[model samples]
Target: MDPEGSRIQDDPYIQVMMAGSTLRKVKSRSWKKNRYFRLLEDGLTIWYKSRWAGRGHSTFSVTDLEAVREGHQSEVLLSIAEEFPAELCFTLVFHGRQGNLDLVAESPDEAQAWIQGVRKLIHKTQTMDEKERLDQWVLDWFHKADKNKDGKMNFKEVKKLLKMMNVEMNEDHALHLFTMADKSESGSLEIEQFVFFYKMLTQRDEVWKVFQDYSEDGEKLMLEELESFLSVEQHEGEQSTQHAQELIECYEPSETAKKQGAMSLDGFQMYLCSQEGSIFKPEHQDLYQDMSQPLSHYFISSSHNTYLLEDQLRGQSSLEAYIQALKRGCRCVEVDCWDGYDEDPVVYHGHTLTSKILFKDVISTLKEYAFRASEFPVILSIENHCSVEQQKVMAQYLRQILGDMLQTTLLDGQVPQQLPSPQELKGKILLKAKKIGGLEEYLDETCTDEVSDEEEMANCDAEMASTEDSPEKKSKAKSKMSRELSDLVVYCKSVHFGGFEHARSHAKCYEISSFSESKAKKLAKEAGTDFVQYNTRQLSRTYPSGLRTDSSNYNPQDMWSMGCQIVALNFQTAGLEMDLNDGLFRQNGCCGYVIKPDFMRDGNTQFSPDKPEEREGYKPLRLSIQVISGQQLPKVNQKEGSIVDPLVRVEIHGVPQDQAKDETSHINNNGFNPVWNETLDFTIHTPELALVRFVVEDYDKASRNDFIGQYTLPFTCIQPGYRHIHLLSKDGTAIPPSSLFVNISISELT
Candidate 1:
């Protein structure tokens, strides 16, 4: 099927977009101006420019855009709603950190036309297969290089196109390939001829050599040979024979090859680039983990200060941040509630310049998106700072807005020794706040009527009570918690942490504790075995320290290694910490929960991150990775006539003894097809807790290296044999065809 729709000419919206229209581009209320916008013939780019500015235009690819929102859904459009009707306004949301574009059409029809048209384009781009996307990318570049309105490109234009594509080719070799592709001898190449030239330039000699090593003949692989390859190289075991037949049927390009039960070079390469050939195992791509275990026996995806979009000090608090976090499979989210105008409660970081958002609006947003990505229960961690009156209002919004989605009662009306599983509590939102009393105390209504100021303020983090303020001043700010709010806390009740032994004796399964990053690290280092044991039966959340005013995150791998269930991170920040968080939750259907390793889930098991070798049945594994080559890597500098000198680094993040990093030598002046063939090996003491990160950077000797792309996955998910590690941008979005081709081998260390 044609990914851009089987029939593009029949759509009216696409037709209107092709014809173009005038829109009022809005950056702010006073910056709105008229601009002419149109979709180019390639159907992958949108160009717009000021009607009065001569020869100055801008263009953005359809692939760069994430979605198009109708009406005034964005903050920029909402700020100007009084000047324009909602129907006449729209917003274009780009991928990653790119700012959104707000536009107002002259009429509602025009607004709807652009909105629906761009949405269709996005859907088509998403549906394109890897091979189809590569072909479209090549064609897009061909169009960019055509220069004139003509449908062909001359040798000079082709040479310029090579630079644009991040390729620094030798003049003689480039001329030879271009002349050979231009078989018509017209001194100019058409689109088809350009594609031929691209193929000749990107021929994978490394892959060809590996293929020749297995094939009886140089051209193709027989059925038995393919089976042997899968068994020996891919570690397919007894299933290799069946997998071989499936590969031949799926990837074999020639009908004759399929009939003869063989695979040609093109077929073999296709098989290698397919999802089956990727580093992550195909089985682990789905929901393979055990979700029926107790809730405490899982590593839950969590976010700290979920309302903030930027720095905690002065960033904007937005409802969209909650929606973004939930959509990214965050099972736990924190909201700090304080008093607001009109006797309502607002969420924001206290003692900071951050903006505030209504508590009711946040609840509404959570209700709409809490289960959109994962059906597992969501824990709403409330840091309450409201007065008694506003606390009542906040409780009312939780019940009214969330309706039946809120888990306000004990499951089966009975308090069990252990908490419920995620599968059992699906489609419910659990409130993690201060409760007046225990579950047994709730049986008597009179005993659980009121919460003291100390109990109420215990849910607040250390930052909430600033050291600059005197004790008397801080006491004056504290307020009592209303009974309505205290009653809403069901499973996840927050309490102050005592010693590990105290928790084991007095803590209930329904109660949880929150620790600052520094405090948690101290406890983990002092009593690692006790921390792991406590987490087996009860949940514990670890959040960033109060000093992280910039909203930075600590390494979550440290907490996960010790069985910390809710290691909340600043979801607004994008870095190695966020990358590892995303990588850990990318498995098990991204349901926001992954079952803890067996030792961590066992109450009596002795497993410490500091002493992994002492664990029962401990067997270390030796991992070997061969960095073969790179393909179509992006250039860091956008300057003209510039190329990147790229290098690949492989890092293992896990137990301290297993932590290691190795890199390949830099390949100068080449971001395309740089061959390393360097093998880096490591001995992993605890493979279950290990994460492997492959990073590609523009190497610089005098200064820090510039990031190109990276990919991280669990060490257990790494598939053996030849594989393609598809790279991602700094913001965690896929940069297709920009990948590292490598071979992997794993075995038990002697």
Candidate 2:
């Protein structure tokens, strides 16, 4: 049979077991009706088919000889010689009697041992329920010859179901088994692609033994390994969608402080009470009454109680003591005009005010306290102590009695007038203007006689030949003759005339107040006026003398460094007691206190308190004492002598003259270097003496003393150490005892 059809074309299970024995040898002569069968057990192989339509030929038909004698005959010939142990050849065929049978084998377990020797010759005459219905018709013919149903039977769907069991498929193998079980181009088969194409063709070698046991170690089956093979249904829905996007970006709240109620609570308690002492005690008074829920605005006066309610509304009137000190929270108030006759503006305070207080009874008590020109805005400093034409007729009757709420200036460019004329009203009503004698009378009336004396000696020989060929136009003609003598000495001291040719013909109007550089280099060398009007102690006595006590060219390491806005102080003499470590007063500049309020009381009290009060009652005395300036005093040294019983003895022979055993032997002396004098001496007792105490054992304990004021010591004293002495008194008594020896030398003074 052509060598058994070339051993069934070299084995696709021996070409499906010799094409099912050539369709059962042409099923009884040219296949009376197709019917083919092959089955093998153990080393598996199964094939079967049946069909009938025309052709007639019926011989061995006793149910086809009892299904070829008992279907899967003896379980496929006793497992085909124990599963085809190896060598086996093949050849077999049958036909004509309306039955078919064929067999051929070489390998494939000898074509499954010749289809298990023809199912052991049809199991010696079938039975066992007809061999379990022919083993489920050969396991549904190998599960319909699996296409891409990836279980195992691979050989291209067993050569397309053996050409549809010889029906011969065409249309390109039925479009390659309808797109090979449709691997997703969605044409069909998706029951997991028909159970992976029937387990890869009936478990092809158990589909490579479960893909080499889950791809052995070269790992890769992703989508998180098919989502851990669908473990716990996709990790709890990806952790509940990442915790709902972190609760929508944590706690919302920011749309511009929620539409400007600026997070309420009365605008955060007025921004925490504008900071300074931020009031809110009593254990945070329930967190300041829950952050002041409704209180809107109320700073209730500060800046030193608003300058003491503007100095008690300048000598009281119906400010009813400044509206009772602004209901106890006072804020600046002062006022005090004069010029009255009918020209109105009255108020009060010294300089012959025979009786005043009008300005319409202080604008009818600020219009009966409805006080709202934007909520109590009344800053009236005013003081015009009299004369510059009666203070411009009391600043035009206080601008016709507070018109435009009296912010001052009677005319000429209206308000903003700080003194060019309106005569010096000491109590300060702002009026500035006079800056340094109006450029020393505009360079003595513009170089007086307009440069005569031979054109000022030919313009000083053409400024010494243009200062070496125009040194910047000889410094712009000496800065235009020192800015025309510093603007004519600040326009003759702003109308208070006097110099600069008596304010260049009786000052009509002038103002300027600064510019000096030594009066502008002496008004560019005497070409004219040199108006002056100093003050910071006459500008520190016109500076230039080693720069007037050069405090190392004045820097002093920012002295005490804070916001130094002080502004005035000079108290050097005029009744000197002001103590606080007496440097008179200037550390960090501009401090005041020149006492003598009759030497500050207490010489047997009597109604004193000129301000500082409130002690144990409710805070407010604000006492910070310590002043010290008169150029930091200290410089005495010791001279005017004449010692008699003056005192300065120290001969302590192993001490012990009781002053508590010489102050406990000078506090348990050790290597005795209490600064100065040497070994020993004693004899200090001084009753109503006069001040002569000295003690120095280890004097070079590096120099100290720089003394300056505060002194006291005439009695009780003691101290003993190495020693020193030298007073003199036995009888001479010149003057060394009216308390003379005043050495005071404690260094550091700048």
Candidate 3:
């Protein structure tokens, strides 16, 4: 995993004996010799004068390497080349960013081997990420622990291995593994055997029992037994059988690579850890949960300060922000409206130097793209700071641009007992600005979401003090809003939570409130049950506080675990937190809404986020996926404008943090149907909690690989088939039809 380390293990093709430092050289200009040379997957190292100490040494990463080949005339290799023999002379030149090193082998074949080997190492070394490092790290551990050098670890080694991995196990269980992993009864466990032991060592006994119960003969389950277990006992669909067959055949190795369907206990263990079957039953997704639960009962994908694309201080605000957010299945979009020239309102960060976009343009863009990506209702969380004239113009723009799609009245006007569902509000946009009722005259677009009394004044002071404004600008800051704009506030009336007891005051369908993450987490801790009960019927939002001004996100699952819907994130940012957000909503058809778990639903039966593992009916999964090949991969953004040395990375993310696994394919020189034919296997104990993402990147030798495209799907939504994964941008937003075609097999292990 070290980018500059020389002693690496994975590639055994180019063998190197421990030679003295007298054979190595660094940056050969005229001549620099008397050094030891060691080459790893990552780089080549030159140590001065036959020593492992750092007194005089230089490491060159593969990314820093320019080339490695036979010596050229007039090069410093002429001097060092004489040390070995005529055939052993090979020179390595470094890129502008790194130092150079030269190596001498014993024979011509060894020299060619080092040349080709170092080039291959560059690709593998530069492409390595945490997952790849883990893979290598495990291999490295296996090698180090094989003290007897029989390619297997003994019973004594097992205890040592467990300690090294930081595992805690009882004596009886350790003995059980000693026998089970010793499959051949050969008195020792090889790499695969140890891997099975590793998987078993980390898994839950209850989960293993569940998986074993699916075995018809109680000894082992092959493809037929698994299909029978799923389709008959589990009542899975007919395709489940196909998935089982495909997975078992893919996982069970055959001499001809055909369908053998032979599965040992270890094979079965790996299957349960994959995505073929979900740990949670389909019920967790509530696919059939009636949309009648009211909009507030579901989790809505929301955005915070949607106008700013970058940082809050100096970013440019554009209408594309709304389009991008909406296209990525964001249900709620925020807009900060300020008075612009000529009776128009503009959207921008209020207290920052961000550029502005016209409010009318944002409205029109929303009207066009609102329901294109997701059919669920769009909640416009407007932080209004416009004049009465501009507020009137804003209202006119909403009505004119949105037409009938804008919701301006209660559903049926009947004072219903429950709020309307997302289904009921389909094709409609709801205004979620503050609704100050009982006012003689409606204020202009000047009410905020929930910046607080003191915070609101501070934001205004910062906004105004940042720049000089005319008298009209000051007047507009305190202008009265038109009543027409206020009328648009139907279901999503942004209110502030007073207390856990008073949060119920907004229990009515239209009086929606919001809480920052700190406030919401506090409420959840102090009144866990009350927090749960409050969200049953009322609509509320939880947003990241201003402290997250850099646009990073808090783990939304923590908020989601408490059943708070409308968890707003800074949609423009990308990372694991965002990946989880995309994963959670990636279910239920990416419709911007997901039915709450029954425990979070009104009149809960028995569901608690803290005890997710104990949640009944949840099952483990075995997923076998073949990353076949990519078709027409878009070139990674580069000035080179080349076809691309493409590679595929398949990742599994979710709960059971340690169970997350990711693998990458070898670099394919072809973009058109580049046949990787690599199988990625995983056993997921928490399928409902896991997400699978495929990232295709263009490989580079001298720098980080440029991202080609990615596509993420909730493990539950993935169906077994020869499917085409239409890729998305790095941000999880849909791109063009450029895709990777792959075969998928999914089976429910328990």
Candidate 4:
């Protein structure tokens, strides 16, 4: 549907909620002000009442906006006859540069319906690419350029349109564009031709620079040059030349059929952005990073409550959450199973309003999507809350669904002093849950001796209460488990981490344990060296605390610093912490595992999170970064004309002992070609622990700044030399070549 023509009444979802009324427009809160909003097919239309509010009206995409229920003062009826809950409003949260908008429904029923309607829209929008979004933006602004309604735009109007897209064209270029777009020599551009011309012109501008960079005498590349470039640089495997030949044929078939051996600018553009030659360079950057390492010697990408999409309470849980996490390269997924309505077990937040999905469905989902995105072994972190019968069903379902993909034996029947590498367990699923009767055999089995039996029982009661205090918990807490489920626990054993001393005790097999952030931090601070030594042999997972009700994530670096193998995060949320997680795990073919630092892997080495690891690579390093041009910088939605004065801020986030902070410079209004021509330098003491994030923001004189896009990566994974940094959206979706072109180098200063 055309965005301009979309109305709320056209949507059946909206019609059911609003009852076919002409009440498409309503009052919503935006940026602390009341704004009139219209529900469009693609997004909500927002406009302020004040005429000079800079941004009079704009559309925020449903893909970037999520409707979440709010519990603050949501009074549907002021003076109610029947008593009701105080809060019933929903906040339209956006996962974009735009701030959140608030909407209140007349009743709780209406609020839920509206939430469902908007959520459906949000899901629909995720499929849309920024390219299509840009097209819509152009169409929205083009009518202004096509004045007098003759369905054509003259050269002057075309020039104005270019400026809106952050393209500055002089008279010579303007006339050339007019001539090219007006293929019939009509002296003006028709709408369809205008769109085609915009796409081609933008593509040309982006690809032309690279063409000039690689071309000699400022022209196209010969077939031999193209083949050499591909074979030597871009292609990963042994068939670079063959792939190059195929690429040339696909893009420059005309020249090839004529027996010419050249690739023009158009051909170059097609080749550069094609799947065969993606600028993001999907190939693994480091050969060593991709090599398999012991599961205990690497940090695994993991998610907490892999079922929940929103908050812990009342959030919708689905198999899609597991799919999303796995798709983003999460290898460890949490599935909290409880007794269901029948023979099948269910997965959800134990005692919350969150919806539940069948345990069989979740296991089947894990089996289907486990290695599809990441080839490494997957660990199903099971939080068991089922009765003996239900637990039997859970085990049965796992065996039935996952089949032989589940790992049932220790590698070679003997637990290695160190855990098996991910390579040894490829395509295997490891169940991580506590075994009921295995502790007596493995006497030194991860039992914490610090607490007495009475204290342990009391603690278990408290834990049960904390998990869920309902009558369901009472029945499930004392349930017996089948020997079959116990047999499935081969590698990932759920054990309580005692003191550091017991962790390094004898006869300890490939047992794994978990700690909340608080407990992990306390243990690390209290026994830093022992923590490091223990991790060398056993794997430890650090999860976010129960206090994170919003599903927000905590920084995994502190846990990583302590050599915790699996620093699990809420993969459903996108923030600085998740950005760091994504960046750290981005290497190694994004197989969801990264080899730990050498010091952390050394069994006898003593290290502390409080200090830099005393290793061979320690040095005072100087990093110099040149802020160069950006490609297709998004327009500022809050501005009058979707314009922006762009700026780049380079931030170094690491330990306090490390070097400088955020350094920024503004290149007023030239978002398309922002150049500081100046290099920002930082001296870091702990180079390995540092994270460098590049944030692009729009400058506002009288108001707070607006975000444009950002790219964050660990210091170790950063590639030097002139390169294009593909940006990600606030929700971590690939924004493609909407990127920064910059030169980076790291030098040892001391």
Best by lDDT: 1
Ranking the candidates on TM-score from highest down gives 1, 4, 3, 2
CA lDDT, every model vs. true structure: 0.88, 0.26, 0.64, 0.67
lDDT of 4 by residue, 558-624 (tens): 7887888788888777787888787777776778888877877888886665666365466768888
**Clashes per model (N, Cα, C within 3 A):** 0, 94, 23, 2
Lowest summed lDDT across 10 adjacent residues in model 1 is found at 461-470
Which portions of model 4 miss their true places by more than 4 Å?
1-152, 156-160, 163-187, 190-292, 437-482, 636-640, 654-656, 701-704
| Each prediction's TM-score versus the true structure | 0.96, 0.15, 0.51, 0.69
lDDT by residue (tens digit), candidate 2, 1-750 = 123323434556434544444232221122223344444331233445544525533222112221222221221222243433223322232221111232223345544544554454344223323223333333444555655555445445545543433222345654565468666665555344544443333222321332233332322222232223223321224543333222112211333433321222222212212211111111221211111110011111211111111222232233333333333222224444545675555665333213345655554444333242123233232333333344445434444544454323233433212222211211212222122223324333433313333322222312122222325323322221122212212212222213345434443332211221243234323422122111100110011112222111121101101101111111111111111111212111111111111111112222111111211221211111111001101113322221111111221111012121111122111110111111222232211111222221211223642221222211112111101121111111111101111111111112
Q: Supply the global lDDT for candidate 2.
A: 0.26
Residue 497 of model 1, lDDT score: 74
lDDT of 3 at 223: 70
How far out, in Å, is residue 270 in model 2? 41
All candidates in order of lDDT, best leading: 1, 4, 3, 2
User: Distance from true position, residue 593, model 1, in Å?
Assistant: 0.6
lDDT tens string, model 3, 198-257? 656544343345457777666567677777756664456678768776666655434332
Evaluate model 2: give its TM-score: 0.15
